[model samples]
Target chain A: MNLLSIIKRFAYDLQGLTFYSFRLFGKILSRPMYLMETFEQMYFLGVGSLFLVVLTGVFAGQGMALQFSIELADFGSKNYLGRVMVIAITRELGPVLCGLMVAARVAAGITAEIGSMKSSEQIEALRAFGIDPIRKLAVPRFWALMVMLPVLTIVTDFVAIYGGYIIAVYIANISGAVYWTNVTAKLTLGNFIIGLSKPFIFAAIIAIISTYMGFSTVGGTRGVGRSTTESVVACSISILFINFLFTRLLVPQIQGLL
Target chain B: MIRFENVSFSYGKEPVLRDVSFHVKPGETVVVLGISGSGKSTILKLIAGLVQPDSGRVLINGHEMTTASEDEWSRVRPKIGFVFQGGALFDSMTVGENIGFTLIEHTDKTMDEIEVTVRETLRFLNLSEDLIDILPDSLSGGMQRRVSIGRAVAAVDPMIMLYDEPTTGLDPISTEAITELILKLQSVKGVSSIVVTHQITDAFEVTNHFIVLHDGVMVFDGPGEKLVQVQDERVQSFLAPFMQSVKNIPAVCPEE
Candidate 1:
């Protein structure tokens, strides 16, 4: 298929899966809630994702610092490294990159595990036993990512800035006070908020797309691989696209209100 | 207790089941025998309300599966259990956790009570206590099957047990063990069963009634022994291959 047709097919499939997920979600909360299952999913989707987020945070911090300091050093303004590092990390890299990392780690894991369960008829077995798969499996993980992603991004943003600051001051021989002053002067609450905001939506998108892909994955190992690939690619693209749109729509309004 | 009347289903437009009609009376064990793609397992899904029929109706205890409310379906579902082909144990969970999943999800049982119940059920399945804490990924095929069966039984006392190709991947010994377990569950649990399989001996050993589907249509409905003596030429041709291969398998007794 051509690119346009592929996009159209993807949109249609995504819309249908979204509708199905919401419908099942409604049923999940109505009665006979799987409270324990939800808790279990939360642990799987949230607690297990910590190390990945932390690793991404540390690496992103150090890398951004190194790149920014090198660039600023040419202009004899290496002291401004912290300001650039903070802005890029918080407002762009923190949420977006962290979301991508999570999309790669947790989203793929969710998709593969759930997809395997689905192909193996374990989902059908759940239905046969009076359990709603959404309530028992999907929603908790969905909400877990939805809740955890933003928090993880915030942590990543802080860690990244700190890592960058440490590298700029100690390794790159920039003055600590100058770096602090530049970052503090350029950085605002708005930037932090802006950076942190995207993760909730990003998390939601990742959870929805990944869960849907996993739940609907057909065939065997090939199918699981395809779904996992689709999940990461689709989630990352959606996160960036929506981040741009959200910035255009919400950022101006928030600036106006402030 | 379960019935399908003129039910039709298709995946996208290719028909998988066409005008299929069958019924399992209360507490009766019905075996559905067919070649792959014959819509045998689809019947279980139809009855369990997993897939809505494209046409006609599936009635479980006089309520249409498609029209039943969520509450109604939930109320009905607990009365049935499905054991899938590959055991389908939650890989991340231990054997005890997998079995206690249903109890934990749907019941108000305390941890202590659930632990007791899980231990009791494991013992009932002749599983060692040491197996309880091991992850499902560590379990053998027969052990996995037992754990899956244990999970299915944990929710409530199922009045109907559905087995979808239970013996598909097992060795002869394991197959015999599963077949005997199916029989024991029927007799001891006093539950109805609908098993879909290609294994003739499995059909003969566990099910009293047999339903055969050919090309998505019900071709025969009778006792298990009658399958061997059916006058239908198509049925005879279908059995011809199994009959030829039956000699290769020794007439071993059912596993304990």
Candidate 2:
């Protein structure tokens, strides 16, 4: 209830998550790879989420292009729509939107699944069989999300840029060639670095927070629901906060490097 | 063989097990009796190394498990199979996969060989081969419990198997069948066991040795017949309700 206690709980959660991430990293690098399970997770998470990601990208790109075109028209340079769209979509909105949306979908599902397993004693059963649940259950999801998020980000970036193309060329009456040229003009290495880095970081954060909430679930079905809700909320807040830090701190540094 | 030496455990400030001690020799069966929250399952959990004691010791096959690392416990764990009361099958996995999980994870056997072993395990459990492809949720409680046992026994010759409330929620026929299956495993595989249950008849049917726990403390430990003779009021009270039910049963039916 108090701010101090809240801070303490958050610190405690971070500590547990750090240890969990360490153990996960150890298992992921070592022997006993669950390649089939990893591939299964990829298909489930990546392919399963393709539609959602694409939809988010489309609306984001279209809206940004249209809004920027209207603003630039007052300055007699509506042609700058594509350039502005590319910068906003690729550098900031694309990865962040994709991260948050996927985090919403995936984090809840992971927590619910693993939380139910925890309540059912299935988690304990895995350990009793001489298998670590982290290695068997969490490892596959971790690797899957790690691999899938970047790939999904690419899909999102591509779809978003295309959506910008549609809005600029058709709705805004900008020439396709000029639109694409402006889009490429803003596609700097700095932009790519900032855009791509967030998803991987977001992936790690989502997997760690969701899986941690899951394993720590206490009660029964009520516990499962509570943890699932907390997993999504924590993941969304963490993703947004990290995105802010990434933009504020990393962007200037990346721009300096460029 | 499994042995506990004055093992005490508490989930929080409240102790779940208080200075409990017992031993199961190789190829022997010991039934642990207790009501809900009486620490019967905790004893089994301790032996399985799922939880360590707050004080004292747990020796599983000569290793002091209280101090064992996860890796050490992993090495020793496969020798002990645990059957949770609720079956605890992986719902995502089908019945065959559940039974073959251990082999699939730990053994070098091919899928075909594993399938054969699963079939053999199902046969040993007296379950039909047709049930292998179904999900665990679809099966009756009794069938699920049997499949759980089959899964435990499917992989290796488990030196010790721990069953927690194995017949708690089954019909009389199912209860009798589960008790018989436990007996069958002991007779056929020579597997040692510690069966936990509040089902007095099923507990009595499964073993000669009995250990009773009340309020997180061991109330009685001795042969099954001697359990009734213990002057402990807590032990008598624990058995009182089940005893009345047993007494009401007619010795012979009219048809007999």
Candidate 3:
């Protein structure tokens, strides 16, 4: 394709995404909510992702702490490792890492599920019965992700702190009291808010991007696989890029509040 | 109940339907016979408001579907039942859930009431109640089609029914079963229908009025008996291979 065609296709895709996002938002706010499906998705997207998110958090925390201890030891400031670890994990790693994991697991699954439904004509069947597929499928998943991602981020934040604590006290030979004091002293309420809020944006990105990919799927099973791959890649990259944007936009404002 | 007046539709630039026009009146069963890619299924999709024509009009129960808004389309959709070629049952849902999906989503009916209605609908479609809780993947192809029909008729008695190749790949017995079901739905339930199929025998079995689409044009439109008698070379060549078998069975076109 030529540059003009490529640009035109990109514009078309952007327009499609914007329209789909608006429809999703409208359906979500409409009456006769599918509470049963929404709660089911909450269990699936939130509680179902607990083990994976926890595993990611623990390893990421331990890895960051180990790297920080090695670097700080050069300056005889190994005692400050806990403070740095907690701040980094809570302010950035906790939300982004958790978002990435959920994006891979939950977002890909949502895309595959809905993509298969589209391929099999089940989505069209929903329409044949006067049921909007977005309302029935996307809305529940969207609401569930929005509600659950922050909760999961909070869980990851605490778990990562404990993981850091384990590494600081045992591996680095820092006093447990000093580590706890530094960890608690470094983080403010603004940091917590920033960390928790990132997942909300990430959740929206994952839900909308994944659902959009699924809905646009064609060509049966192969199309479903392509959609799943596209959803994961798009959501993962979007989360990373948006993380930087959010930090740049929100961090200064949050620091000002403190 | 369904009318297509000078409708023309295309996929991007390649036209699929070209100024095709036909009407299916209440209690009438019209079968659209065409080779693959002749835009047979497009007609059903247009009637279901799943696809809009590029020009002219598609009317379902006198409502102009081409210009209708989303809410307006939704209001008209329930009045028509569409049975997709592949059954299109929700794979994640059980047979009962698939059949009762519309009721559970749209109606104020209690679970007990829904279950009762589901059971009755299944009975009407000749499906066993024991298969209710099983997922659609576990069912046979023919069984899945039956469940699809059950789902279509479960919510409300639709005024119009559109079937997109209801029996494409099936055994002779299964094909007969589906044709019988289509006939029963028309004679018993008084549901108007537009069936799109390439199966000549099946079309002859179910439809009263027949229309042939070749190269996106309606080449023939008359009674099922007249389909075999069409002078158009394309229609003749299309039916020449099936003429021997089709001739064995007596034509049974219902009186208008």
Per-residue lDDT of candidate 2, residues B151-229 (tens digit): 8999998889899889988999888888889989998999999999988766767677889999899989887656766
Q: DockQ score for model 3, please? A: 0.83
Clashes of each: 0, 0, 0
> DockQ winner among the candidates?
2
Q: Candidate 1 on B1-256: residue-level lDDT in tens?
A: 8888899998888899999888888878888988899998888888788888889888877777778887888888877888888888877788998999888878889989999999988887878978888998887898799888888887689988988888887888888878878877887888888999988766767765878888898899986456677889878877887876544323432222
Indicate the residue-level lDDT of B100 in model 2.
96
- Give candidate 3 misplaced runs (Cα > 4 Å): A1-8, B249-256
For candidate 2, the per-residue lDDT at B235 reads 94
lDDT of 3 by residue, B1-256 (tens): 7888999999999999999988888889888998999999989888887888999998877878889998898778877888999999999999999899888887899989999999999899888999889999999999999999999889888888889999999888888889999999998999998899999888877865889999899999988667777789999989998988888545454555
**Model 2 ranges off by over 4 Å:** A1-8, B245-256
Tens digits of per-residue lDDT, candidate 2, A9-124, equal 98988898889889888888777888999999999888999999999899888888888888999999998887888788888888888999899999999999999999999999
Docking level for model 2: high
- Candidate 1 stretches greater than 4 Å from native: A1-8, A24-55, A66-79, A171-173, B244-256
Q: TM-score per candidate, in order?
A: 0.90, 0.96, 0.97
Q: Which residue pairs show backbone clashes in model 1? A: none
Best by TM-score: 3
Q: What is the TM-score of chain B in candidate 1?
A: 0.92
- Per-model RMSD to reference: 3.5, 3.0, 1.5
